[model samples]
Target: MTTLLPPASTTPAPGGGACAAAATPAAAATRRPVVGSVHSWDLSTGVDGPGTRFVTFLSGCPLTCLYCHNPDTWRMRDGKRTTAADVVAEAGKYTRFIAAAGGGATVSGGEPLLQPVFTGELLHRFKHELGLHTALDTSGFLGVRATDALLRDTDLVLLDIKSWDRATYRKVTGRPLDPTLDFARRLADLDKEVHVRFVLVPGLTDAPDNIAGVAAFAATLGNVSRVDVLPFHKLGEAKWQALGRTFALHDTPCPTPEQVTSAKGVFETHGLYAV
Candidate 1:
């Protein structure tokens, strides 16, 4: 999940260009403008990353998380075709405002790593060309797809550590929990700055043990600079209806303020900053 800690993609698209295969940094720079399936782009503050960020939401994701708010981004074909250059150019317009706000740019997805080459191109150009701080928001399921060159351009990572309990994690994302953990350890090894995100769903992911599990692991990472305890909401329920898919958590209530505070406390107890 792109920090929508949302389920996103890594399965290569069928067509050509960056969506098809990995490309070296030199290849990405010299090759024709890398292309990708993009959902939308917008400016937002607080949640995505530090400052006021120009966030790009790429298309396609492999997992089908039950509480996904952005179900519309689940498929590559559903998005409009665009190029990395075009996306960067769009972000370029906000460089001044973003800089003033102490923000930069973020490449999020259905999964950015799903389209590694295109994503890398966007990040590299965003940092090197636009002179902006860049972040990659992902679930880390496809962390293997993120080449070293890509990580070089990423100043921060907004990672969704959905659920620490294996069974709950699978029930929530329809995938095993290990890949995300593996990726977390890898990021720590690289000493990458990471902001861990956890969605506090009252019934789904609010168990004390689950929260403790995630908190303890994140504290061990040594590279996690912040933790965001996001509250669950029905904001994306309408999108699910439009997609003709049942919103599994339609009746699930958002986490209470107390629950959110307690969850944050768990991380704090582990010696990690939480908000």
Candidate 2:
């Protein structure tokens, strides 16, 4: 969560020259302009990707996860109407610095796939125009919305597996586990690079069998390069309270260092790198 707030203002940075080479005139003409509900944009490092990232948090999501900290982002109407070009322009302001740090651009949630077309445009422009590495941060629930072209533009994917057991998965995110597993398998088939994410909730998802289930599935995906064992935290409890919603996991304790280490060991046992 090392995030820097969006700059007060942005100017169009140099280089849309790549745009001409990126698409054919007829294709560009037929395509509708990309617009989206954007909650915010900022700079973040480490967890989001290999280097510092200009992360665009698109608004709206289908899931109502009990542990979601950014409840403010749940509704699409709450976000500002933004164009994909404008978002890429803002990221351009930091292109040099980001490239210097070996960082890239990340399209994050509410759920990037919630606005697939907009998310796709941003990824395409971020890579082709900005000449930066690009990552897609998504839950993979709407993986069907992601066209093959979108995945091609995305250099990496930060996919949240969340849970393994079907019932437990629904309890955590109010969604079925099948779609995520299906998406993981698809990414594997494509040989796409993926960093599988799991949030270790002490009483909820920390069960040995549940963790083992996730580890075992992820290990089967040849494309999985890393397993991020994130411990659940209540930092967003206030956001839930402020929004007048009861934070169900209000009293959920953050997993201890030992618990985290143990969970990491589970993935390592499956021959996957864990962090």
Candidate 3:
């Protein structure tokens, strides 16, 4: 299961930008234009990225995935307004802890690219000020927003490739798949380190052709270091219900171990590392 820690309290920074001081009151009222809508954060190990991570959950997503656990993050307005300085201040508190564990900061979503400026600034500070590695967890729906300048600061990308077929992609996530494919190609061109994620839903995304398509695509990207085939689960049913939304996969079974192994086999067959 993904470990979720309590939300980190934020304080305003002395200033804005990548060189801002890491001291500010936690109760500051003003919101910077480059600020992000933050939902929550967690300190996790062996999941989000390499080593332990101080994962910041920035709110505002463009895609509406069927199995999104944190449905509360769907909207752009329902989150704490925080500047890059505030995030850096909060993450600074654990600098030593994170470094000791060989982990860094991961800017996850709702989609981090939705708030490109804030995400970029936060990434810059995390790497320059704190001397930490940076990773971005995104579906690439808004990948166009990830400018070359912003991507220059990012060390790795946890790219989620939902499906291979365009129709099935639209069904799983209320968005097209070509943009993600384009983003993947761009990242490959830039030689960015990427860990590709694909969730294996039993009835929706477990088709042999879909798996092969994704794996074949990944194999073509020399920058893709690993492929993570995640199993679908009903862990977010309650969240959907609490939000007064229909949970479409109530009867959808989780992929069995054999199914997961088979999916992994697809990636392996393409000469890509899978887990």
Candidate 4:
């Protein structure tokens, strides 16, 4: 079973920390945004719904997931220094297209939570000024207390649940599981709309018992609008090679359609709806 730690007594304070303070002004200036690394944008990932989406891959993540696709995003000092407004302006050009098609901006990355100030500011502008649908794709590794302010204007959360078994979770992401589970539950309790995502890696997260465990836990979340079973792929292998890091899941096979079908069924059976 997933264990949830008691809600933290204090919420993380609003405004930028040293990291944000140091980066924001520069970002605000030349739009030469720098975080960990400023990699080129790939408009793919298929996360944005039905419309033209503007996605920003922020830098820095806490987890070292074995199957991490963007291992390059792990560092905290490599990206360009673009302000929140810079991102919004660029995304604004496509706003008309995104709106007509029912899509908007999605902030994804090395864990957008790692850059809370920038993410918060960006979302704030998106909602109050641009009036766009904002989506946050995160691992939920950053505890809820740290994220309360950030979620205020977020329209949707694409939460990635790495594992149901704590031990297995640590093996997969090199981090404890409780905090992530707590983050998930807190979002649910707050009535925040969320879509749970699980990457099904054969022999790792694909065991029937594990799938059932995840489904059972997800079922308890009253605000989960959908559960997505993302089949494992080797798309990030080359990226790892480019970054001079060993691809840990090199031998892990992608899940068969049967596995995806079966896993989806498990989620449905447990009362957690899947999309």
Q: Highest TM-score, which number?
A: 1
What overall lDDT, based on C-alpha atoms, would model 1 receive against the true structure? 0.87
lDDT by residue for model 1 (158-230), tens: 9999999999999999988898899999999999999999999998899999999999999898999999999
Candidate 1: how large is its RMSD?
Answer: 4.9
Off by over 4 Å in 1: 1-27
**Cα deviation of 198, candidate 2, in Å:** 0.5
What would the per-residue lDDT of candidate 4 be over residues 194-256, giving only the tens digit for each residue? 888998999898888888888898888888888888898999899899988889889988988
Inter-residue clash pairs, candidate 2 = none
Roughly what TM-score does model 3 have, to 2 decimal places? 0.88
Error of 4 at 262 (Å): 0.6
- Candidate 4 regions off by >4 Å? 1-45, 48-50
C-alpha lDDT (0 to 100) for residue 221 of candidate 1: 89
* Collision pairs in model 1: 1-6, 8-61, 8-62, 8-110, 9-61, 9-110, 10-114
Q: Give me the displacement of residue 17 in model 1, in angstroms.
A: 15
lDDT of 2: 0.86
When sorted by TM-score, best at the front, the candidate numbers are: 1, 2, 3, 4
- Alpha-carbon RMSD to native, per candidate: 4.9, 5.8, 5.4, 8.4
Kindly state the number of residue pairs that clash in model 2. Answer: 0
TM-score of each: 0.91, 0.90, 0.88, 0.84
For model 2 the TM-score comes to 0.90
Q: What is the lDDT of candidate 3?
A: 0.85
Sort every candidate by lDDT, greatest first.
Answer: 1, 2, 3, 4
Model 2 lDDT per residue over 90-203, tens place: 899999999999999999989999887678888988998899999999899999878787889889999999888889999989999898888889888888899998999999
For candidate 3, list the clashing residue pairs, or say none: none
